[model samples]
Target: MTQQPVDDIEIVAALFQLARSGAIYTKEVLLIEAKKLFPDVPEERLLDCRRQLGERLKGSDYLGYSDEYDRQRRRKAS
Candidate 1:
């Protein structure tokens, strides 16, 4: 069985659906879910799709990290 290549639009749509589910998710969690949905897709490609989606949704109320998660990320960065 051959798996059809998933396109950027499809990836973006899947990510959007997961994001807009009223549940806030950290980047890691979102990426994990995306990977599960697109196991055949490369992680790099998934990351790129996620980046684009985030850029498009910036300043909107669609997908966002919680304040606590943001703080934790910052701490990890330091």
Candidate 2:
């Protein structure tokens, strides 16, 4: 069987899928894995991806998923 070629889009999708499935959790952990997969990506861009993925995974039961904490933090920062 031919293996699918890995790319940035596929990698990001897999990361998000894992989070959605409750396999991988925590935005920090996801960002770390993303950096490992695409070390050349800019830090700011990675953070943006992290934020976007986090938003998409909202309400998931993934380990470390925490909308409440995020909201509380945002309220405190406001």
Among these predictions, the greatest lDDT belongs to 1
Query: Against the true structure, what is every candidate's RMSD?
Result: 5.5, 6.0
Best by TM-score: 1
Give one digit per residue, the lDDT tens place, for model 2 in 1-78.
985555545655767766777756687777777788667778777777666655666656477548677778999999
Q: What C-alpha lDDT do the candidate models reach, one value each?
A: 0.85, 0.69
TM-score, one value per model? 0.69, 0.49
Clashes of 1: 0
lDDT for each residue of candidate 1 in 1-78, tens digit (9 for 90 to 100): 987887899999999999889574788889999999999899999999999898777645445555556779899999
Q: For model 1, give the 10-residue run with minimal summed lDDT.
A: 59-68
Model 1, residue 18: distance off in Å is 0.2
Query: Could you tell me the TM-score of candidate 1?
Result: 0.69
